[model samples]
Target: MAQEGKLDLLLKTVEENKKRRVEAKERARVDFVGLKVVVEGRLPQVEKKVSDLGKVLGVLSTKVEQLESTVSRQARAELLPEDIREEHLDASPSLSTPLIRGSV
Candidate 1:
């Protein structure tokens, strides 16, 4: 009778564990679905923002190149005599133009 009782208790525990496992699996599946839905819903907006950022990066890159070029020209001009510097500046009007803050 004791052995039978032990067997019954073991069976009951096994069944409870199985039930818990199934419940856990169902919860995980539901959570995954909810996460998928959320990600899918935001994916387009995220992509668009990324694209916009890429455009801004491209613009910023162009401005950096322009600034680098202007700095290079100014450096070269400083190495030259005043008369040549004036002539060089005259040849490239942009080199002499004062940069307004935030204009780029």
Candidate 2:
């Protein structure tokens, strides 16, 4: 059609989209407030559960770290030569590929 008609259609579409967006945003805001209220009501319980989980995780992490260290010590004592024990300990992630190749 004419340029003015096309512009008018575009303006109408933009306004309709703006209205829909505003409505969607308001609905989302209401849902968020309701969700916040629900979460807030359960705050103490959630905090307690989170705290317990943290304690369990902390204990697990400590045990894992201790196990790793023990395994590392035993491996060094058994498999590694004495001269390279310290060097190997320091070399574990110290080496890198000399070349960087991208897609062949």
Candidate 3:
């Protein structure tokens, strides 16, 4: 009868919906697995690049520290009395002649 037909149509619709949901879930799983594989393949390269960057950063840090130390020493020397500055310059092998006072 009419009720039986309605029941059958409803059951058919429910089955179709269930099938669609299952297919969608399977597609999502496949996509996730593909993404996982790609990421796994590239992870090592990413890690290596990060490590290289860290090494570069370390070298840069050391250079900066050395430069800072040199600057600090120069600043301290500049703050000394003119006589002391001349003495230091005379003692340095690099400066064979003392700098004239008040001369650039």
Highest-lDDT candidate: 3
Tell me the TM-score of model 2. Answer: 0.44
Q: For candidate 3, what is the TM-score?
A: 0.73
Which candidate, 2 or 3, has the higher lDDT? 3
Say which prediction, candidate 1 or candidate 2, comes out ahead on TM-score. Answer: 1
Q: Best TM-score goes to which candidate?
A: 1
lDDT of 2 by residue, 45-92 (tens): 989999999999999999999999999998777765765877877878
State the local distance difference test value for candidate 2: 0.90
For 66-103, candidate 1 gives per-residue lDDT tens digits of 99999999987777587787887788757433455435
- Encode model 3's per-residue lDDT on 6-26: one tens digit a residue: 999999999999999999999
Question: Using Cα atoms with residue i matched to residue i, what is each candidate's TM-score against the true structure?
Answer: 0.75, 0.44, 0.73
Clashing pairs in 1: none
- Candidate 1 RMSD to the correct structure: 14.6
Q: Count the clashes in each prediction.
A: 0, 0, 0
Candidate 2 wrongly placed segments (more than 4 Å): 48-104
lDDT at 75, model 2:
74
Give the candidates in order of TM-score, highest first. 1, 3, 2
Candidate 2 weakest ten by summed lDDT: 95-104
